[model samples]
Target chain A: MRARLLRFGPDALGKAGVVGSGRLYAAVAAGGFRRYATYRAATLAGVFTNTVFGVILAYTYIALWDERPHLGGYDQSQALTYVWLGQALLTTMCVMGTGFEEELIERIRTGDIAIDLYRPADLQLWWLAQDLGRALFQLLGRGLIPFVLGAWLFDLSLPASPLTWLAFLVAVALGVLVSYSFRFLVALAAFWLMDGAGITQMAWLAGVFCSGMVLPLNVFPGVLGEVVRALPWAALIQAPADVLMGEADLLGTFAFQAGWAVALLGAGRLLQVVATRRVVVQGG
Target chain B: MDSHSHSHSQVDGSFDESHDSFSNNSFNESFIELDGVEKVFDVRKKTGFMRSERREVRAVDSISFRVARGEMVGYIGPNGAGKSTTIKMLTGILTPSGGRLRVAGIDPSRERTRLARRIGVVFGQRTTLWWDLPLIDSYKLMHRMYRIPDARYRENLDRCVELLELADLLDVPVRQLSLGQRMRGDIAAALLHDPEVLYLDEPTIGLDVISKARVREFLRDLNAERGTTVLLTTHDLQDIEQLCSRVMVIDHGRLMYDGPLTGLHEVGDSERTLVVDLERELPPVEVPSARVVRVEGPRQWLAFPASESAAPLVARIAAEYPLVDLSVREPDIEAVIAKMLHSMRDTPKPPPEQAERSGRAAS
Candidate 1:
């Protein structure tokens, strides 16, 4: 078996090499950057919207606190930090939407998926690697730059320690894995379902609302917040922001995120196997 | 297995001994084998939101053939006749539902990766190379994929470029090239790994005549020099006539005919149309096994069984009637195929009257 695997190594690499050479990752990155660069104009508009919402929410929080020491284990500074982190991470995560789903559906429709099926490499792994490459570019070129600029201009609370910064980087990697696995699992619905785009949209919307994109999950009602905290969607965005803001327990957060990553990765693989079997049975 | 191999060798030895005493004949070996292979597709038709309709489409019915090394075999069929499906099964792109298949001694469906290393495939309608990248970069990527040695890579690349005339187009993005140019590049890309078997599906579908000829010539040379086994599927009969010595005709998911091109022409009662021009206007020339199809102004077109010797008929015409111009046109492949398909539609009918009579007399 080991010998066979070693011999198969070059075949897998060849499959990956064909996909990688297309410069698709670079094009996707460039496209994201161009869209976001033009979206800087929208950022100017978001500035006003953020200021209005922040001031109104801050006032409402202060009035509710009645000068109390802390609310929900967060001091006023930390509470404000949550707001800023939520806004910034929302922009970052939202930049990597399920755009590849349409392409996947089209490929499946046209029987182009046969090419990937014939390759020696694992199809899901190949696509995940490409998506990872695209995510890295978007995180750097589209997400990080604009995020830093927004925070700097607005005087948001930044990470206080290098350890916090390091933790944030780890969290970001886990977050991307979780997000990509979820999106890929959704896209694999094309094997069984006719219109996977609708499913993707619903999943994206659910993730956006439940993962604290519009508002911090802590701001939700007691049961709702607890439910959101338990779901994997929170680990995609909220957990990363928690690390960056030094609000999460380091080891516990890492363990939780790792657990979600492993579970989702396994689920994605299982779904891939089932979907592939279904496709084969369908004679595609 | 060892005993089987020994017996096989012994059979070969005996055959060689018998032939070696007479003529110096070189025999090409079989690289692929398909024994009573069958592939059935379960085509499902979803009706309303709740219920579903299901049916089976036997894309490839029970059929068997072998491809010899260094031989180019043309697989021709009409649309939906399962040519692509058969190619897919042979290349390990699709698994067969039943029977045995082997390529290079490996079951392609079982050891696809190993099989892929020995075979190259080009589906003409699709571009396997990266559309956004320059064609050269795609080739380099493929080189890495197939792990071609640097020296071999350079040698193959140079040879392919020279053969396909792709030097000028290598640096251009695949999206920028014309269809013909892109197909040439695609063919070159598929051959970069120096695979033993090349499966070409509609390789010249959209190519101009010049490009098509260039492709055919390149393929001919490749087969000659490398002894590569080629299984080409094309709608263009010209491609078959020019490249393949053997042809397999499939229709309605079954092998209707599998042999030399001559087998199609020798359907027992082959007919030829002869157009004759007479010096003077007219007399009805009565000849057995010949019918006048059309007559206009000193000219008469006659249809006759080609089995009726053309020499005597021509002599009789020359001796009996004054002729200004005469021409005989062989039946076109298109017409032959059309007739074959028409016969296929009328499946329950006996053989044609002429063929039946000839068979009865022989019996």
Candidate 2:
């Protein structure tokens, strides 16, 4: 046992070293970060538009409900909170535009993917890490800041417990993982289909409608709502919002999120492996 | 006598064995290997939702070559001749339909990451450097990506700046630099990791003569000093002539010729032109071993096989005419290559000026 452990130690360390050495993840992270810095003006405009849209959505909900007891187990305050949360998470989760898929297609067309293939890190994992970094920056710069400002102006419900906050944090992290894996799977379509943009747009549309970004999943018809809740898309946004509102049990909510994360990430990995094999066979 | 004969046979056997080993070693040391590689692309036409039209285009058909360690090989072909397709396969950007490829001792398709670590590449028309940042910042970012040690990074940066003459351009953003400056900086960025192999696709495609000379000089020095095997694909024959001793010419997805540069000139039966200026108007004269191409005022021009000795033709013309001035021009490589490509039909004639000179020279 000791010998085996000793042998495995160096190999594991070496693998980690390789990942850190910028073969895949580091290059992508650098690229994504640089891209964000360059597109600062555009990001600011996107944030402004998103915040204004959130306020309009909150006002529209207020007119419909008008302090009437509650609709779909959410009061006016909770409804307003949901609106702000959805707006913030929209940017963080990249609900409007799954840009990574387009990036992958362009990379494929231009043969830039060759640079990524040579890296010592898994391409999927590298892209996920870079996306995660971008999400973090956007969530802070575009998502969280805008939401806080909007909430202060609109009198939205804030979470009451540190436990709820902690749960919300975990949910958001898992949400990003699940969301990125799903997007990556869509991006891998470039290997098989020549114009992957149409399919990518459809995937983003599905996420927007089903993930409760434009409206809460509970508003869907009974059977459709049930189906939507069970899907990974809802878990990326709705589950985090539920946790923040104290409407979900911490352990149960996280357990479901974990399940979705594992399943989606596994699916992504399988698709990536198969897509890469096709690329090798077809010379994409 | 029997013992002597046996010893001689033994020596010959060992020589053969060593020669075989040497050939195998040469192939093994190559950074890239394409063995009977074939890539056939399916050309499809999609019309609304119906079944699409399908046509087959053999982009890279049964091409094979080896780029040895530190050997700067140029892969050139006309447009749509599968140069990019072949490059894509070598870099693991695309896969071959049939045949095997190994890059940097790894099957590029199977062990892409391992191969990537051993090679650095740059596409001339595209900017891989960050568009917004200064060239130095981009280099620093690449340093982080490749995880170069700080000391080694500094040393390589210093050397690249000195060799590429990039000291003045480092502070400028890539978007701001002139094409020549940007190209030099881009090449430096690709070399930061000290990759054992470098692939440059059209590195001098669009540059002033001085810039082209600087790039060629840098590439030549880098190859000689570092032994970093290079695979360059360019439309510029001047680049190939000056930098590459060996040339591989591909046409219509097939390797037409792969040998020394001299072999290119030898493959086709072409002719060199000799222009002679006489002190007086010259009458056309019939001469053996040469064709009289044209006659103008005081000048006469003639064409002879490039393989034919210039001395004999020059001596013949001088003995017959009062020669005031004389010069010899070798046929352009572009014309030669074009002729070789289109030789199945009538070859395209040289430019009018060249034709006039050749006509006058031949007459």
Candidate 3:
């Protein structure tokens, strides 16, 4: 990026830099990172809450897994690991919180989205970059510490190989993509509905149950298990945890996550086009 | 004559970038052209708790005008007069429902992102700066977001900082800055990319006298030196008086008057207030062709036609009453627009003498 600064001319600042530009998105992502990093108090509070929840959920899972050994094809250690992973990922996936969608919805309500549209960048890509940065920061600031604490205190299944860790990281990234795309679509609903608070609540409810955050989708009964596992929300926590536990085929889980990410992102782009076509920014 | 004819041709003809030099040929091409552009919003009203009625509100009704390159024009209107709607359509935030609208040979809605590269907008009511970050951080984000050259970005930032007097406020977070300071910061952010045209919506709305003067002076220099086309929407007539050569007035989503500032006063039948301080409290000043609107202790305000000279009224008042001191105040643009809209509402078509007065004033 600094190399481009040396070649100073009008050509260096041309429209070509805006189309499929890596540096532009990276800079926006960094901006998002810096923006979230400013809320030191919020990060500390979030990390504390996640650690408390991890302890509570780990004990519950230990009790249940002990009653039924090898339940849902998982031993006691796997169930406990799933519980800790779910707690760690609660904020990173933004399943319960409104996340960036809260601010986006407010912007639409106040007609401040007009300023966002006045920028010389793709709207979807700009927000996607911001969400990716936010997810990464939350992962480090809120996700890692709680999981490390939980693993130290409890008997948990730890990944034995580096390759599995690498695959887990990739799955986690794709998980963020799927979740962001879904949230982006929900945020765009504010354009037509003029208020998306109700829709956001419904989305959060679905995410909590279907993402295997409260309990592993693997333990659900016949039809419910299959249905929850097939949902895009499952890609956020269940699939990533499964990859880390080395209980799922790497290629198969990735394909599922990648497919949902592409489909949801494509739908979001379409909705964005339609929504911006006749934008009715709420207030004058 | 050559400039006027060329501008006319540029508006009527297809998009042409041949006369793109902004400095040398200021009026040789039309930078912004609108032909009967309109915007209608479908607003729903809750007639009852479980029922509603959808109504189509025509916010911008077939407004058409052309702005030449390097021209600083004032767009003044009432709160709901569709001035903002027009500006939004021009910026591509709201798509026009009918007719053609072009800014620098590009349809704003069709090529919004492309056009965003060339135009800058400032809404005085809202600050675009990052609230949590320092003032300069927002500019850094824009620097990369717009892909501005490092040298040019630094040059423009330095120039804005120096000219806008933002040297001390650069490190302050936006949420902590006062309204006037944040406004100056926003103006600087808009200019960092060196856009060719700027749209300022009430840039002086909440500014103090000194800050307003600073902003107006900076804008004047920016226009004069860079030949940047500026479309200003302000309720303060002084902004138009000091900066713009022409003004357009909109009322009820229609263009009511488009001519020189003085012409608008004549056409709208606006009034000027004459404030006089008498030696003691009097009943009222008796004068023909003027009415006392307000009277306080030892002071009185009289309203007279703006087109009439204050000399005769002053002489008459001095001869009849004990006048200590006096000054005449010009009517504000809002009052002018309100009076214009009120008169137009009374008579669908303008009276002959009013038309003749406007015609003479236009010349």
Candidate 4:
């Protein structure tokens, strides 16, 4: 990655901004990364909340399994790891979908979207880049801290094999893509809904329960676990956490995540085309 | 997104080179041409609880006009007059519902991104710069966003920074800067790619006297030096007075007047306000032509038709009352537009200029 970064160069990135240019999308992604870094207080707050939640969830799971030998596939220790990893992936999934609602809705309401659309870049890709950056930032700043704190606080078990760790990382990355695609679609709802707060909140609520962040898929009774795992929402939080805990098959989980990412992305692109065609900018 | 016109050729080297053979002749010709252009918005209003009525608002009625290269035209109108709708359609921000619109031989809506390479837009009501980043950061972002060549981007940034007096403020976050400073930053950001045409909407809306003067001067120099076509929408008549040679007056989605700024007085048939002071408090001054619109202690404001010579009214006032002091004020563009809008509502027929527009066909 370091060598490839040097090979790309700054001039290549500048030209990336032209319409239909992939480099432009990467540049925008990097820009989104830099933009999210500006909110230092928010980053710290997110880290704090996520870490605190990880501790609480780990303790709750440890207490839940005091009587049972094993609940689902996870032992008491594995259940604690699941809770910690789930907390780590919380921001990346953007269950509340980050600051996209306010940012997009404000632009739509103010008619400043005129300037946004006036640019040569594709609107969907532009936002995708921003979401990717935000996901990366949350992954690094908030994701890592909670995992480390949970590891220290809970004496958590680490993946024994390098292959397991690699698969876990890949699953987390896919999880981000799945999360971004879902959030991107929800954000587009702002164009149609006068105030998207209700829709956004509902999406967040659905993600929380369905994505296995509230309760692990394995905890759902036999047949219910299969249904939960089949849903794309589970790929965002459950699949990555399950892979990290070695509770799910690595290859199968990766394939399922990749499939969901591609599907959601295709849906987002379609929505973008439909939304752009009949743009009814308010308060012009 | 529509990629039909983008084609990569539009963003390569020289802007003119990318526009192809059609641009060469059209370059010096009518740079901005609109024939029978119109924008109708389907607005929904809440008639009652859980119900609404959909209404089609002809924001920009069938309008036609041609703007030559390097021409600075002022587009002025009262609230909801569709001045903004026209500007939006020109920039491809809003698609026109009817008629044909072209900017440098490119269909603005169909070739929006392609046209973006050659056009710049600034909405003074909002800042395009990144709110959390320094003023220069937004320019740096634009530097990549517009694919402005390195040398040209650097040179333009430096020139704008120097000319716009944005030197020390470069590091200040946009949210921290004053409205005038942010506006200058926005203007600089727009010009970084050296666009051939610029659309400025209320560029001096909330600016102070000194800042407004600076912005107006910068626009004047930009037009004179670079020959950039300017279409300005402003409520401040001074912006038109100082920068534009011609002005287009729009009202109720129709072109009420389209001609020279000097010609506006005749078209609007404006009025003049004469504040007269008598030696003592008086009921009102009796004048044959002028009527006292307001009266204060020892002072009275008389309204007289601007078309007629003010000399006769002054003579009549002086012959009747002992004048302490008197001064005449020309009818401001705001007042002229108000009168124009009122007179326009009184008649069902379109303005004389608009009557001839249906004769012109789309290119």
Best by lDDT: 3
TM-score of chain B of each: 0.74, 0.77, 0.84, 0.78
After aligning candidate 2 to the native by TM-score, how far in Å is the CA of B305 from where it should be? 7.4
Model 1, C-alpha of B65: deviation from truth (Å): 0.7
TM-score for candidate 3: 0.88
lDDT of 3 at A8: 25
Question: lDDT rank, highest first?
Answer: 3, 4, 2, 1
Interface RMSD of 3: 5.6
Shift of residue B111 alpha carbon in model 4, Å: 1.5
Candidate rank order under TM-score = 3, 4, 2, 1
What clash pairs does model 1 have? Answer: A14-B145
The lDDT of model 2 is: 0.73
Per-residue lDDT of B66 in model 4 = 70
Provide the global lDDT of candidate 3 against the true structure.
0.84
Candidate 4: list runs displaced more than 4 Å: A1-23, B1-24, B42-55, B272-292, B298-332, B344-363
DockQ of 3: 0.39
lDDT of 2 by residue, A88-206 (tens): 88867877665566787777655566555644346776677678767877777778767987888887888877978888988999888878877887888777775677877898788
TM-score: model 2 vs. ground truth = 0.79
lDDT of 4: 0.78
Q: Using Cα atoms with residue i matched to residue i, what is each candidate's TM-score against the true structure? A: 0.75, 0.79, 0.88, 0.85
- Against the true structure, whose TM-score is highest? 3
Cα lDDT tens digits, model 4, B83-158, are 8778878877678999988898888776677777789989999777888777877887787777788999999999
lDDT of 1 at B25: 22
